[model samples]
Target: MAHRPDTLEHAPLGRDSAYPEQYDAGLLYPIPRAANRAPLGIDDDKLPFVGEDEWHAFEVSWLNGRGKPIVAVARFRLPANSPNLIESKSWKLYLNSLNQTRFASREDVQRTLLRDLAAAAGGSVSVELLGVDDSELVPQRLPGECLDDLDIDVSDYTPSAAHLAVGEVIVEETLYSHLLKSNCPVTGQPDWGSVLIRYKGPKIDREGLLRYLIGYRQHQDFHEHCVEHIFTDLMQLAKPEELLVLARYVRRGGLDISPWRATPGLTPPSPLRLARQ
Candidate 1:
């Protein structure tokens, strides 16, 4: 299988008196399929949130009959208040199941996944599926640039410093990005990749900004929710004149998802190209 949970250790999540690794089998990443998972933030738990932007994905998968990788690009939109939004862990588990699936055609795979993911998320999710030979339809450019992993240090906030309530940026009018590196709050297994944030408002404190991002260094949350939480934090804290927060995470189990959000009037920056691509 492209994604093998048996070999990949994970953080556990469930009810157990002994407090075992919070690993959730469903939270497995690098799904055998061409997919990825992203959570907004762990702190956004206290707020009411919804999916607002369009999700564009470029996926490469292999067919059971051909044994060659087939490429697909999907665009899914979730309602702001869609109930039963598939939790990150569960979503990963679901994608991994596709490994053994052999669809008659790419359309069948697209239709099935769109229907199933939408149903699991409790809202209509749109998907644009494409074969490897068809590449013209996917998004061409992305926002921001590749990050240099600034050797961030989080010694002070290492052991549960504080739950994420909100973040403050010390830098003024700047563009910053950090590769996303987090773990399952349960198992402590690391989830990785990059994140980009750009805004036109007063620049936030860089140190504070790093601290905010670092806060999640040890904390665990889904990629989609993490980005969303960051969006909410900016709206609540700095309230920049114009703001855009986007993260392009590396693929796990062959899947990756990028989430974006902004104020009603402001438009999000285009997706960017990073080394991982």
Candidate 2:
């Protein structure tokens, strides 16, 4: 309970591939879910891509069996660069598989969850059970300072109108998250999460940083792909001396995707809550 609900807590008919508003199939009230549908475009050659990466995760969730709805969060670490980046919707689907499971033991439940999610993700995942009674987990990193509490300003730059040429920015470790929740302009779904950005470069324009992030307000792509595109764009325009970009999402259907990218030699800082994977 130390984190948000694992159930699909969005307004029904949102943009998940299977349950879009277009489907008009009614809301997924009994706890919606997903997995592995996001990574489909990973190796697209048309995009002036950046680096390669691997994704690992340990996700957790379960049915109360007691008739009461219980929200669960599993915590685990992923390698900084594993070779298995997952497809997001597939992740939602995998987590939903647990919707009907009646866990007999918390330990057994945790073990099974880790195994299944890892397999579905095409990578290994870890699971740390956060009891059903726990309070929703909010970032311990901030409160009144949280971006969720602020009025955000949109970016002035156009993503389609690149900066003409590539540029780079370098800076010490710093992390930021926003609910600016943007979805694929094409699909119109909400992509939620707190993104962690760390790098050592010539220093990026903070406003530009904000603008660049806003550019994705209507952009469409998977969580991993989005981060990679951003990383690639910045390295070309800002030309950072060194950089690492990561996005750790809150669970959507008992599954969460945390994507990390670094320009070799730069060690991305791991949140104490995250696994060292």
Candidate 3:
């Protein structure tokens, strides 16, 4: 039953809107990250993890100098420590604005994206425009054992840190589940995704972990916030020496968002899409 921050009051989500006729940097909307983090007991100046939000835009199209249409995909990386998180609907609308705009070259489009996104994020944002045939666009499965087949009783659908527990056995492992689903805070639309956990510490109770993840079924939040919540919950319950929590969400409006949070010194996982993405 968490509510979106007051900063999102005027965001483009949940309301009807028309596509922009031309490029408009002003279309991008940003919500302060601290607003959501405050409730989680996370301080903006002392974040517990390091990571980024990987975003892919699959329906990008623009005009070349010759007035011919150019189609390509885009990848964006926004640092987790950024001051703000861009609103997804506004991001879609901002990208849609480029549909009829003309750019001299792909680099030109990328530069514009980088500048605008970085400004909105309040941090440096990585923007890459790739051809549709780029290999990075190929889908792959998430690493580790899938927890979807476990037969466990569950009734609650709200997230609770108490559902997470760990055993005495110490081990290093990776586990994942595709049943992670949460609703959008603004529009209440379902956001389906797969979540992966990697840690080196006491053996976590798989059933409890799965139940904890499933508890978000009726939760409301953004993909980045959800991953952070999972990460924080695990850290509090297991006290792992190392931990990483990642969520790869399905595409909505031609875009997919994957957010990962990890203890310092752990390398990030490959930014690859799952088959369902």
**Winning candidate number (lDDT):** 3
TM-score quality measure for candidate 2: 0.57
Question: What shift in Å separates residue 140 of candidate 1 from its native position after superposition?
Answer: 8.7
Provide the global lDDT of candidate 2 against the true structure. 0.49
lDDT, candidate 1, 1-277, per-residue tens? 1233422234224322231122222342322111222232323233333344344454334254555435565555554444333434444445444544555678777777766766555467777665444544433444544334445555643312232233354433434555356665445666675566776665565545666666666656556556666776766666666666666666554455566655455444443334453
lDDT scores in order? 0.50, 0.49, 0.91
Q: Name the best candidate (by TM-score).
A: 3
Winner on lDDT (1 vs 2): 1
Write one digit per residue (lDDT tens) for candidate 3, span 104-156: 98999999999999988889999988889989888998888999999999998
1 against 3, candidate with superior lDDT = 3
Q: Where does candidate 2 have its weakest 10-residue lDDT segment?
A: 23-32
RMSD of each: 9.0, 9.5, 3.1
Candidate 3: regions farther than 4 A off: 1-6
- Minimal lDDT window, size 10, model 1: 31-40
Candidate 1 TM-score to native: 0.61
Lowest-sum lDDT 10-residue window in model 3: 1-10
Comparing 2 and 3 on lDDT, the stronger one: 3
